[model samples]
Target: MKILIVGTGGVGGYFGGRLAQAGHEVTFIARGKHREAIEKHGLDVKSINGNFSVTNISVTDKISDVPRPDLIIVSVKAWQVKDIAQQLKPVIGKETMVLPLQNGVLASDELKEFLPQQNVLSGLCRIISKIDGPGKINHLAVDPTIVFGECDNSKTDRVYALEKVFNDSGFKGRVAKDIQSDIWKKFISICVSAWLAVTRSTYGEVREQPETRKVMRDLFEEVTELAYKKGVNIEPDFVDKTMAFIDTFPPESTSSLTRDVWEGKPSELEYQNGSVVKLADEIGLDVPINRFIYYSLILMEEKAKKK
Candidate 1:
């Protein structure tokens, strides 16, 4: 399959490398030092599963340089979806499938606003990875899974074909029964952990401390309420389930948001907690926990944007 990876950071680099390893034609869109490193030394992936490099593959800073792909995996930060969608217009063919593996639930919707609805897929990825260096990707944790489906959860040939592509590429890919619910399941865990982790606590510290744990539950409940209000089918015991999932994380684990904030880089704060607060407010629901998290860190977020 011909694939275009919109961002060659952790998620994009790891998965795109795997695809290229499987002999698929994969092009990566990267910038600055990362793009330079890939063009010179190839894209290197150091994974717990295995380490490999894909040299002589197409790497470019501009999306227009690539041909129309069969699939476009958007692995950029959730907050960048809107602008990325705009830039993708020229390369998006009628049959191109755009899969957004962003952190939050709003990415597909954001894409729909700019692109054709038929071209966007609701999706999320489960992988702990990042750019370890300019052209290097480190797969630190998780089995590297991508859960995706059509917007209405219908079974389609394209969905299954993509699943086959992932299977051949050496990763777990499942067509979700209900992609919206699956997305929320991911959102609940990531949103709760990210805000708490920003308080300079690791997963071990956040889960082990009583006061912090309570705050975690409160944050989970607020997002749950927001999910319910938004008509997403989150189960009643989802909070407990999500907490259990978090418990499975390695003790020192931190969310991407926390790491970005620590490095003084722009983050998905607006798309994560900030989106929750905004969505909840629109429906007359109070999400005090999310609101607090959003407001408290917003100043820092603003400062990061300036940098």
Candidate 2:
């Protein structure tokens, strides 16, 4: 299948490179040093599973230069969605399926407003990956699963084809019947962990500090309540399962927001925690913890800028 990865950052770089290595026609849209590196030395994937280099990949800075693809993985940061979506118009065929692996919910709806012709699939990528340097992608662990489905859960041929491609490439990819609930489950768990981990020090810090761990659990519950109020049928033990999943995080493990803060890069706060709080307020629900973290991250971002 002809595929184009709109942003060659963490999620896009790792998954797109994997698909390319598996012999699919993949082109990476990047800019500046990252784009130059991929053009000159191919894409480097660094992971615990294994490491390999692919030099046969295609690279482009302009979307018009690429052909219309069968699938487009819109993996840019939340803040860059509008600009990137505009650029992606040239590469999106009528039947193209856009799977955005953003951190929080609302990506599909947000993109649909701009590109209404293409099919938008709600997706969640469970992994910690980042562009370590110009040419290398740092894939942190083995749980790099990609879950997605149509908004209405319709069994279309495109869904099955994409699933087959993902499964054939030796990655954990599944189509959820209830993608909305799956997105909420991930959002509730991740927002809490991202806030607590970045606020305290590290995942290790939260794991060791009983108080922080308890607070994290509380934040998860609050987020879950907000989700329920928003009309998602989350599992009763969803928060517990979320806490258990977070317990496996590596000691030094951190969120993309935390890393962005430390490295003076932009963070996706408005979508992750801030969006939850915003939605909760619209529904007349209280999400103090979520609000506090959202505001705290904004302050952290400002502080990082001054450094």
Candidate 3:
């Protein structure tokens, strides 16, 4: 399949590298030094699975340069959705399916608003990887699952074909019967984890400290309740399961928000934590922990800027 990856960050760079290495015709859309490095050397993926280097992949900064690919993977950060969706007009054709592996729940809707003619699929990627440097991605976990489906929940031939390509490439891909639920479940885990980690505390610290653990658990419950109010049938024991999962991760393991804190970079706090808080208020619900987290991260961002 001819695929175009819109954002060449860790998610895009790693998975797109995997597809390209498997001999699929993949084109990456990136800019700045990262794009330059990929065009000159190649996309590099450093993982426990083994290092992969693919030099034949095509890459460009301009969206106009991208052909009408059969599939497009929108892997950019959640905050870039609006502009990126608008910029995708020229390269997205009617038959093309755009799979967005973004955080939160509004990406597909935003994309559809921009490119109504194209098919926008809702997808969630479970991969612990990040752009370690320009043109370099660090894969930090064993899970490489992608759960997605069509907007209307119909089983289409195109969905099956895409699933085949994903599986054939050696990555775990499932066509979820309820992709919306999948997206919400991911958001629940992500919001809780990101909120806790944004405190500049390690996972071990958050898990071990009774007060911190309680706060984290409360936050998780709030998100789950809000998700239910929003019509997503998330698992009842989602919090317990997610907490147990986090306990097994490395003590030093942190989320993208925590990574941003450490590196003095901007975070998607508004889209992640801020989204939940805003929705809770609209629905006449109170989520104090989430609200606290959203504003706390804002203060951190401010401090970083002043420094």
Candidate 4:
């Protein structure tokens, strides 16, 4: 299969490298120093699963040079999805399947704005990965799971085939019965953690303060309720289930947003908490907690950009 992986960050780089290791034809889209490093030295993945390198890679920043891919896996930050999707219009073929592995729930809808809905899959990845250096991906934690399915929750052959592709690459990939809800399940946790972590700079403080933990759990409840209101078939126990999951985050762990903020980088603040607040406003639902976090982070991000 000819696969195109956009934004060779932790999720894309690690998974794309695994696919290349499985002997599949993969093209990577990256820019700047990262692209230069890969062009010269190949992509390196340091995984707790196992470390490996893929050299002689097909990588370029130009979309015009890319072949019409059988699959396009988008791993950019949630905020970059729209522009990337528009840029992908040239390479998207009638048979191409686009999988969005970013955090937050807006990715598929954002892709749908530029590509056919049939071509977009509702997906999210479970992994802790990041660029340790130029052309280098570090998988710090998680078993590297990818849960995806058709946008309408159909059991299509394409989903099964993609699941096979993921499994063949030695990652835990599966089709979700309800992909939107699965996405919301991921959203509930990531939204809470990203906001609290971004605001407080560490989970250690929140983990210590009973009141902060309460606020954190409330944020999860807001998103879960919002998902239910939006007609996603989330589990009834989503809040409790998600809160338990949050307890397991490693002591030093922070959301990707927090990491990006610390590095003075642009983040998905708009797509994560910001999206939740925007949606709630449209539906006449109140999301004060999400609203507060979203606006607060926007200020922080602006300050970071000026530095």
True-vs-predicted CA distance for residue 138, candidate 4, Å = 1.0
TM-score, one value per model: 0.97, 0.95, 0.94, 0.94
- Tens-place lDDT digits, model 2, residues 9-80: 888888898899889999999999999999999999898778878896899888887767888898987777
Arrange candidates, best TM-score first: 1, 2, 3, 4
Give the local distance difference test score of model 4.
0.86
In candidate 3, what are the lDDT values of residues 190-287, reduced to their tens digit?
A: 88656555667877788888988888889889989999999888878889998898787678767776787667766667678889999999999999
Candidate with the greatest TM-score versus the true structure: 1
Residue 14 C-alpha lDDT in model 2: 88
Q: Is candidate 2 or candidate 4 better by lDDT?
A: 4
Cα misplacement distance, residue 93 of candidate 3 (Å): 1.3
Model 3 whole-model lDDT (C-alpha atoms): 0.84
Pairs of residues clashing in candidate 4: none
1-307 per-residue lDDT for model 1 (tens digits)? 8899999999999999999989998999999999999999999999889888899988999999876799999999988999999999888899999999999888999999999999999999999888998999999888999999999899999999899989878999999999999999898888874565467888878999988889999999989988888889998999998888888877887878888888888999988898888888799999888888889889889999999
Poorest 10 consecutive residues by lDDT, candidate 4: 193-202
For residues 194-213, what per-residue lDDT tens digits would candidate 4 score against the true structure? 55545555665676678878
CA lDDT of every candidate: 0.90, 0.82, 0.84, 0.86
The TM-score obtained by model 2 is 0.95
User: Worst 10-residue stretch by lDDT in candidate 2?
Assistant: 192-201
- Ranking of predictions according to lDDT: 1, 4, 3, 2
Per-candidate RMSD vs. true structure?
1.2, 1.8, 1.9, 1.8
